[model samples]
Target: MPGRSPRRSTPQPATCRTCWGGSDSGPAFDAYATAWEADAKTLTDALHELADKIRASKGAYGGSDGLVSTQAARVRVGDGTVSTMPAYAERPSALASY
Candidate 1:
């Protein structure tokens, strides 16, 4: 035992049956469903906000004109520059495929 290393226990998987349609999933599923709805709402709200910002930027610059440049144009979003245009545009149905 002096030279032997201590054995580590196997880590348990962080999972809930109720959330993923397993046995005894009633209460767990309910709780997870509530949280899922809240998350979905938050994502939708954030996407809407981004869309509004893009629209405002379009008005300030010109529609599609500001996005296009002789050289590579980068749009600033917060502290970072996004090198693409359509990324800021809103497509509500885009997440529907998921």
Candidate 2:
């Protein structure tokens, strides 16, 4: 529909009714794994890169975050159902530790 809005993404798992167990936010997430000590920086950098990719792909899938969101509207009218638009991603209320 012409007035339909796009879906948004939530950064934290809390909105999904769950909690994230890992710390891949930046370089420190991988640092927790001792075995990856040597490649800690590399691993976190890759993680950051992966996060970027996730955001990039979303814009094409009806998402507004410019990442994991879809690039276009995924809902079709006259399907007898309404799309549950995703909420926009917002920064955490407080800084969290891993």
Candidate 3:
């Protein structure tokens, strides 16, 4: 995200003209830099939006997990014990084929 931040010192048309001795390519370089800066800003904005969505989703998932755990704890098996699922790592035999 930092790398995609808009450059503060983007080459101005005047600066490009000076660098190129007022050559015809100066305008072209200026146009290219302007377009690139605009694209970078767009990308930065999109990334920020994506980060916000991810944070919101994370909070939602945490709340859902807690609710599910509470519900699971309330259910009892035939032995009157709380039933729980095993983690994938605890079931290596189930992944033997993979």
Q: List the candidates' TM-scores in order.
A: 0.41, 0.27, 0.57
The 10 consecutive residues of candidate 2 with the worst lDDT sum are: 14-23
Q: State the lDDT of candidate 2 residue by residue for 1-98, as single tens digits.
A: 68988877766554333335444433345455655675787889999999999877765554445443454456456656666886569778655753
Kindly give the stretch of ten consecutive residues in candidate 3 with the minimal lDDT sum: 82-91
Flag the better candidate by lDDT, 1 or 3.
3
Candidate lDDT values, in order: 0.73, 0.61, 0.85
TM-score of candidate 3 against the unseen true structure: 0.57
Ranking by lDDT: 3, 1, 2
Put down candidate 1 lDDT per residue, 1-98, tens digits, no spaces: 89999997754333545336655576676788999999999999999999999989978777456457733455446667656656567668967989
Task: Please estimate how well model 3 matches the true structure, expressed as its whole-model Cα lDDT.
Answer: 0.85
> Candidate 3's residue-wise lDDT over 1-98, tens digit each?
67696758878877777777667677777799999999999999999999999999999999999999999999866766555776347545776988
